[model samples]
Target: MSYIETTMKKLQRSSPGQPEFYQATEEILQSLRPLIDKHPQYLQQNIIERMVEPERQIMFRVVWHDDEGKVHVNKGYRVQFSSTLGPYKGGIRFHPSVNASTIKFLGFEQIFKNALTGLSLGGGKGGSDFDPKNRSEQEIMRFCQAFMTELHRHIGATVDVPAGDIGVGKREIGYMFGQYKRLNGNFEGVLTGKGLNWGGSLVRSEATGYGLVYFTENMLQAHDDSLDGKRCLVSGAGNVAIHTIEKLYQLGALPVSCSDSTGTLYHEKGIDLILVRELKEQRRSSLIDYLESHSDAKFTPIDQYPKDGHAVWRIKADAAFPCATQNELTLADAKALSENGINCIVEGANMPCTADAQAHIIATGMHYGPAKAANAGGVATSQLEMAQNASMIQWSFTEVDKRLQEIMKDIYQRCSETAIEFHQPCNLAFGANIAGFRKVADAMLEQGLV
Candidate 1:
């Protein structure tokens, strides 16, 4: 291995907690490997080590009374990754999978994602290991009340803002926001993704998914191509995947397949957006239920894709968006995508591709868009929600969507220009790392060894 590779491998193994954090840092460091010689301070200041670790990691116990009058306890966490640019801002996830390692990696990724948005919000993530699935409304409310009881002290409108993530949706946000209001006794924008009647922005829900398509559209245009006739595969049946499909349809692209944790469904013609929305949002049922409703669509377990590789990456598509989870796409999958002539990849989920998978794409000269740059649309629109809340105004969908598109285009340009300036054209990971890192690093320099 080369010196840069050896350096990154050494640093990666020295860290503690989730393997995902090391996976994420190794991807960024590999991309930025060429820059260390010129910017020796990156090594001297130990920015790789400092940046890979969260500034503060808070874990606490949440105890609350259930509707059954039973007291239950759950683990909660808030990882403040970086506060270089401004106050901490990220979403709070409530899922069975949430833990310190998961939160740490997420918070670490948020630093760059927030910076890429050109917003003055630093990076942080908070959440609990409480799964809301299949729970009664009262039970969810009780849990949210309990979760916020402990989380309320650490967040504020100007301090750290938390929004919806994964298992935390509008209902969860409403409960938490109400608790925050009750505790603070003032109407402050401490949380986003609230109901429109409250203070939520018009396009916040669709921002991340739609923004992924918008960024992908720009990348395609740069290559003298478009999404018009491309066969698209999007993983995940959640909010992000659903809306990403919607926007892809709007832009004349045919999204053919989507998956849930259970299985993947492929429609040879195209996925019906209305039916999909009803099945996912209204019914909150399985993707399998959609298959039962539509006999024409084919349902296959995640492992059943025809190719001998990861199902999501093995599919023959003009484009692929992995909206599922971290490290979902493995290195072998990356090699399959390269062999299949996959045109472009845009991450709709945080750190969806493993470090080796990312390196495979970079080595193959494929168009790769990192999560920090591609997924900034979510936080960018979240910041817009904060602005709307502060001003007591709600923008129309067209106006908000137009701004989202503009921000995505701006992100594309910034990454592109940075890549070119660094003599690594089309290397978006490098562009994003350097571009986002410079902003936060400069802020840290100004703050002076805090």
Candidate 2:
């Protein structure tokens, strides 16, 4: 068997029943075939083998009390995938769907994402099956405290720093940081995505969304096009999706849709940022609530979605941003988007597109931005937060935003140039994997076998 096939078979055998992890591994390894062929030293040194396995895997149980004095327990995980480049860096998610496989997939993707940022950071991912939705503030705080009680031992400022993801937002980060401070008795940068009043850097919350747009803009510029006056479709109503819409408006693009687990909200005229923030961020409500105020807007439930594709992708638009969860954009969804005239697709979520979906999009000649390169802005900003904390200084929003834009531009250039070097011009997914892998692989080689 070939080296890539051999590695994938071993991974599948070792991590059985982890479809997400398997998919992520296959996607990255398949893309690295070109690099492996060019550099036989990597094979001789068994670099790919070591890179596939995480440096550490942590699993723990968290117990907390609800407002009614009921005891609750949940499973938590932390996969420190790699630290060859720098400290273990990623996010801590709190959601019902979080599992070891999910965390592994996220951590693996993070390795490449952090590398593309051109920053001294590594890759890691941690989370729990604890759902923050519908929980009282007191319950959420108690859960955060309990989760941190265990997670604090595995993470540190310079060793392994984690930020926020999905259900773990500013509120979740604040609670966890408070607990860590009380337990460890030191206020270090053990975590990113903190509240602005604390060590959190400015524009950190909007970094991922804004960065997605910046990368997309760069791609358009390279193709002699622009986001100006473009009709866009954005999935997910969370931080990434909201910020993506915000940046799209700033660039004069009309974003027409945002969704939640329940359904998608489509506004033909363009989404209302104020109402969306009030419903999602403030009230913690669903997109269906959005229609209560704007009767003109349409809400399509997941059950009512098309048999073969997602409702969001079926919407005719110039661009589509899959800011939702993994495997959200299926091959059928890709076909639907192509049929609907989507000219560009930039992933705002990790592994949002399935392999077949991504291939289909690329085969159709659409400009595609993979998650690792396109969504590095969030982690890049998280590293910036660490820098601000280490220096005991906070930068203005404009300053942080300027740095984020520059970082995204640099990442785009790196991906574009690497693609050309590989003779696969414009194949960003392939370019990203190669560029990110080479840096970390070289670092590992110089460090010697661990």
Candidate 3:
């Protein structure tokens, strides 16, 4: 058998039927196919299989009292995937879409993303299927407290530090942190996305989105290009999307599209970040609000984004940043992008692109980066927040932001160098996979099959 097929067969043999974890590993492995011939050591150890599987998977039932005086039970999970380099560090997402498969995929990706940060953090992730979409504040608080009541036992500051994801924002984090404090009776940096009034960092909210832009900037520079005068499309209206829009504006790029779960709004001029922040944060309104405010913009239903019920890749642009959930883009979308002449894509959300879409991006010879490497700014800043909490000090926005830039640059260098070393130039997925995989694998080797 060929080396690639053999390696994949070995991984399947070792790990068994784990579709999500397998998908995460296959992308990295495909990129690293060339490495098998030179460094047979990687194949000998079945590193792909070893790293694809989590160290531990915790699934529990979170029973809570709703504001209506009724008890509701929801399934919760915390996938502590790896701790090879350091403690398990990742975010806790709370959305109805979360499941075992979803968490497994996220946790597996976290291992490499954390390693790419150049920090002493391993990879892990946790969350639940309890959707906080329209829940009352008190309802969310009770849920968070109940979730933490059980979760506090499995995590700690130096063990597993989870920040915020999808529906787990500052409010959710505050409730969880308070519950942890009440249960444990000790104050520590168990959570990374805490309020600044407590122990949060200055740029924590902006880190992921801004960090995405930073990575894109570096990629563009390598191509002898820049973000200046580039028209772009960004999905999602959350923190990452908003901050990414702000950063895009700051760097003179026009972000023309943004969306919520309900719909997508596109303005030929550009999206107004201030209005978007207000709509999402204050009113919790949809993208239609922007169109209502400005006559120049157009609002379309979510599924109708491409006008023919196809993906929106046909929309011409210099860059595409998918900041929404996973598998948002399909193979048709990738083909549309290829036909339309897209320049590059950088994921702001974890696994935002399908395997086919990713292949299309690479097949076009466009600059592409995976979420683990491209969207690592948040975790890098989370580690910084941990340091601040440990030292009992806070840093200015400028100070934290400077450090964030340096970390992103360093991550870029890691991916770039690893790709070049393996004679696979510009293949960031391979570089990131190998660079991150080697670090954790070595650590696991040192710790010995536990």
Highest lDDT against the true fold, candidate: 2
lDDT (10s digit) by residue, model 2, range 292-324: 888999999999998876889888999999998
* Cα-based lDDT for every prediction: 0.84, 0.94, 0.86
* lDDT score at residue 59, model 3, on the 0-100 scale: 89
Ranking of all predicted structures according to TM-score, beginning with the best and ending with the worst: 2, 3, 1
Query: In candidate 1, which residue pairs clash?
Result: none
- TM-score each candidate: 0.94, 0.99, 0.95
TM-score of 1: 0.94
Tell me how far the alpha carbon of residue 67 in candidate 1 is from the true structure, in angstroms, after superposition.
4.5
Candidate 3, 416: how far from true, in Å?
1.2
Better of 2 and 3 by lDDT: 2
- 1 against 3, candidate with superior lDDT: 3
Better of 1 and 2 by TM-score: 2
In model 1, state the lDDT of residue 268: 74
Local accuracy of candidate 1 as per-residue lDDT tens digits, 56-131 = 7788998876667888889999998888887798989988888877887788888988998888889999999898
Give per-residue CA lDDT, model 3, range 291-366, as digits (tens): 7789998777866666433334556788888898888877777777667667788999999888878887877788
Better of 1 and 3 by TM-score: 3
Candidate 2, which ten residues in sequence have the lowest lDDT sum? 306-315
**Backbone clashes, candidate 3:** 0
lDDT of 2 at 118: 97
